[model samples]
Target: MAVAVAVAALTLVPLAYVLVSVVAVGPAEAARLLWRPRVGELLRNTVGLTVAGCVASAVIGTGAAWLVERTTLPGRRLWTMLMAAPLAVPAFVNSYGWVSVTSAVEGFAGAVLITTLSYFPLVYLPVAAVLRGMDPAFEDMSRALGNGPWRTFFRVVLPQLRPAVLGGTMLVGLHLLAEFGALQSLRFPTFTTAIYDQFESTFNGPAATMLAGVLVLSCLLLLVAELRFVGRARVARVGAGVARAAVPHPLGSALPVTVLGMAALAVLALGVPLGSLAYWLVVGSSTAFPLGMLAAATATSIGLGAAGAVATCVLAVPVAWLSLRRPGLVSRVLERSTYIAGSLPGVVVALSLVTLSIAYLPTVYQTTALLVAAYAVLFMPRAMVSLRSALAQVPPEFDDTARVLGARPAGVLWRVTLPLVVRGLGAGAALVFLAVVTELTATLLLAPIGTTTLATEFWSNTYGLAYGAAAPYALLMIVISAPAAYLLTRESRRTVPGR
Candidate 1:
């Protein structure tokens, strides 16, 4: 509990900074700053993009999962891999690809389309995992009651998928709220992009923090909506009956159409970015690869990503364990608090860390440790969510039995608990590593002097419209992220048919 509280305190630093900054600005001044036509315009753009993106991603992701997991689609295995390959490509990199290809993919429509393609995998993976493991008895019962196939799915299967769907959509919404690179490149003016502009263009801390304050409120609203929709209902198996393999629904005449649709999704999500990278390498006049610089940046990105992933997951274990084992108000609040930092834009989190470090700990300012701490603050929720799910599946009886055998607390954790939850740890670490590898705003602001990460390098080249020079960094990021994405795919294939 003490460890969890400390972790929560660390995670809450960014929120505290926002509140303190807003208070320092005084209420009237804050109101005056926020009450403007510009703020209203930004609010409209941010809210519209978030809502539309989440809905579109949910629809596409859920539909794709159902097709791959439940129907007799051709090449289910291949489709599973292709659906998740988008995660290997960052949203910003994906936008870079689209922009390089055509100018038409800009503004609100383009933002929605690009983000949905990038993030729908967030929804698809979890929903597919649920679909793979879910017992089909509920469907059988619904069918016996005379419901048609679609009706049975809506009334029976969809309800069971609520937790996974809600979890996924909430992630998409929060990600959209904090998205910076893709939105900026796509010419969309959202809160994140506006906040970055305010800070960079004017160096006005109060104005930027005030914008962040509003963004935090939006994050709170999203959390509330997700919580209310999720409720406290349990969605697990009730008895000890082992789940049987789900029978795939035959597509018959629709098989070819389903295959074509999957192919189209793959083309949009994976092909565009890759093809654009190859094109830029061949034809862009400014395209040049400096091997020495590229090697240094790759090493730095991997080093930082690995360090940040380790630190974040280590901090997450206690919080996740407490929340599951205690199941009380304090634990719940601590766990939920971690998500607030993650929902904030990377600029907000980075600025907060910068302020605290400069004022309170000058020695640590502009250091690798500070940067790693920032990564933990921004991405701890990813680890927490994965750890909590993993810990939930582990029976407490195992711990008790170990204790009865004369094992100490540390012994049980290291000897028994760790082995059982190792996969969860890996999954959480991989998720954090992937985020850190692609993180741009935070790395740009917080990284130590002389440290250049792949994300920062990619952003610099792309910002100058040197697509050819940027292509290599973007491609390396995708390559580095591929192993993590594959691990996630392998982890989700628990009950996939024919596996």
Candidate 2:
């Protein structure tokens, strides 16, 4: 119980500090800031990009998932891996690739394109999982009743896919809200970019906090809407019946067109960015790699990522256990609280921490602890989601069985529940660790004066047009993040039922 409380406290402190400092300036100041032209523009851009990105991701992700999971498409297994591999390529990397290919691709359109490419996988993974798990009986019955492929897909499969689609869409939306590097690189202005600008140009913590408060409120409203509209139903298949795969509808003359289109998208999203990175690496190698600087940045990134991952996983365990086993208003609230902080842009969280630190804990200001706190706030949801999935697999009956055998609650948790869920916990930690390694906006703002991570190093070198110098850091980030991405994809595939 004490451990749980401490984890919860750790997760909440940064958020609380941010909120209190924002509100400390009072409502009038916040209101005045909201009325400013800059705020209005930021709001418009943020909402527009989020809406556009979410819609595009849903369409693309769902389509890809359907093709890979339900179709008799050739190379299905390979396609599944290719579909998800884009997640390893960060949004900024994708943006850099696109920009390298064409100078014109560096605005709103570029932001949408890069973000969609990077994020659509979020939707694809879950949708594919749910589709794979779906019993084909419904579709088989529909066909027998004379419904065409399109009609059956709409009337039968899609309705059943609502929960998964919505869940994936929610993840995409949250990511869009928090997105920074891609948007900044694409020369788009959103609340996140505005917050970063305010932080960078002038250390206006109160104003930045004010904007962050509004950003949080905006995210809360979206969360409420998603919960209300998306519903709270599980989409898993029940029973031990052998569910056959859905019959793949032949595209006939359209097959060539469909295949080509999908292939082109995959190439554009995954291939182009990678090609650009390779080019830069080759060019940069001519000038020699900055071995020492690279080593220091790599070490710093790994250390912080490891620390944040462990911290986030530890904090997420209690929240997951509470929500699953001791679920109630409080548990639910605690669970949702993490999301509130998680969904905000890293800039917002970083600035909020900066404000609180400068005013109250100046001693720890610009320290690693403060940076890790920002990471915990920004990436906790990934840990929570993985933990929740792990907890779900550990049946409540197992706990009851342990109690019946005379084991105490703590002992049962340690000996039975913990063992069962530790894999999931480790997977969750890996997810957070990878995310932290590539994280940019927050690290830029919160990292100590001399501290450098791969992300900051890449950003600096790239901004200065030192493509060769930037290549090594970018390469290192990709290499470090690759294993984690693979683990996540493997775990997701294994746990996702049929597919």
Candidate 3:
């Protein structure tokens, strides 16, 4: 419980900083900053992109999952890998790919397309997992009552899928809110980009923090809306028998079209960025691989990713344990608090840490420890979500049995509890590692002197319009992330007795 509280308090630092900083800016000054036409335009752009991106991702992800898991789409396993492959490419890198190919993809439309391609996997993975485990009994019952396929899906399967869909879309929305690199590359102006501009271009801490406060409010609204939609309704399986695998729905005459659609999705999501990177490598004027720099960046990114993943997952364990084991208002609040920092833009979190560190703990300022803490604060929710799900699946009776057999709490956790949720630990660690590897804005602000990760290296070159030089870093990020993406695909797969 104490550990959970400490973790929650650490995660709350950025939010606390934003609020305190905003208050320090007089209300009248804050109002003046927020009420202008520019602020309104940014709000509109941010909200528009976030809404469009989340909806498009949900549709694409959910549809693809249905094809892979519920329908007789050929090469289900291959398609699963292809669908999840986009995740290996960071959103900024995706935007860079498109922008490099043609100037056409440069505004709202492009932003939506790039982000949707990058983040839809968040939806697809969970939804696919649910579909794999979903009992076909309900669908069969609905069919026996003479309901049509679409109708049955809408009424029965879709409702059961509500939780996954909502969770996926909510994550999409938050990512969109905090998205900076992709949006900036596409030349879109949103709160995140605006805040970055305020900080970097103007060095106006008060103004930047004020903008952060608004962004935080937007995140809160999103969370509230998701909770409201989720409500108290139980989406879990009600009665227990041997849960059987859902039969694949036949596409019949639509097979070609379905196959073509999935192919297009794969090409758009994976092909374009990868191909663009290849193109730059082969033909771009500035293309050159400095193996020394490349090796150093790759090693740094891997090391930082490993460190951040381990730290984030370690912090997540206590919070998830308390939430599942205790289940009360305090535990709920602590768990939820960990999520708040995640919704803040990486720049906001980074800047807050910079301020807090410089003022109170100058000794740790700009240290790798500070950067890892920032990673933990920014990505804690990823670890928490996985851990909570994993922890929930393990019955407390096992812990009781272990305790009864003379195992102490520490022994029980080490021997019994941790072993049971080891898969979750791996999943959570992979997720945090992925985020840490791709993180840019926070890395830009928080990385210690002389440290260069792939994300930062890529961003520096791209920011300078050296697409060719950036390609190696981008490609390396994709390569490093591939195994983790494959792991995610495997995690989403639940074994059915046969095919």
On TM-score, the candidate that comes out on top is 1
- Of candidates 3 and 1, the better by TM-score: 1
lDDT of 3 at 10: 96
Is candidate 1 or 2 superior in TM-score?
Answer: 1
Off by over 4 Å in 2: 1-9, 141-148, 236-253, 284-287, 354-367, 389-427, 495-499
Clash number by candidate, in order? 0, 1, 0
Which candidate leads the pack in lDDT?
Answer: 1
Winner of 1 and 2 under lDDT? 1
Model 1 misplacement above 4 A: 238-241, 394-418, 495-499
State the weakest 10-residue window (summed lDDT) of model 1: 490-499
> Per-residue lDDT tens digits of candidate 1, residues 366-391?
99999999999998877876676567
Candidate-wise lDDT, in order: 0.87, 0.77, 0.87
Tens-digit lDDT string for candidate 2 (102-153): 8787777878888989989777876776676577898989999999989999
Backbone clash pairs for candidate 3 read none
Candidate 3 versus truth, CA RMSD in Å, comes to: 2.5
Lowest summed lDDT window (length 10), candidate 3: 231-240
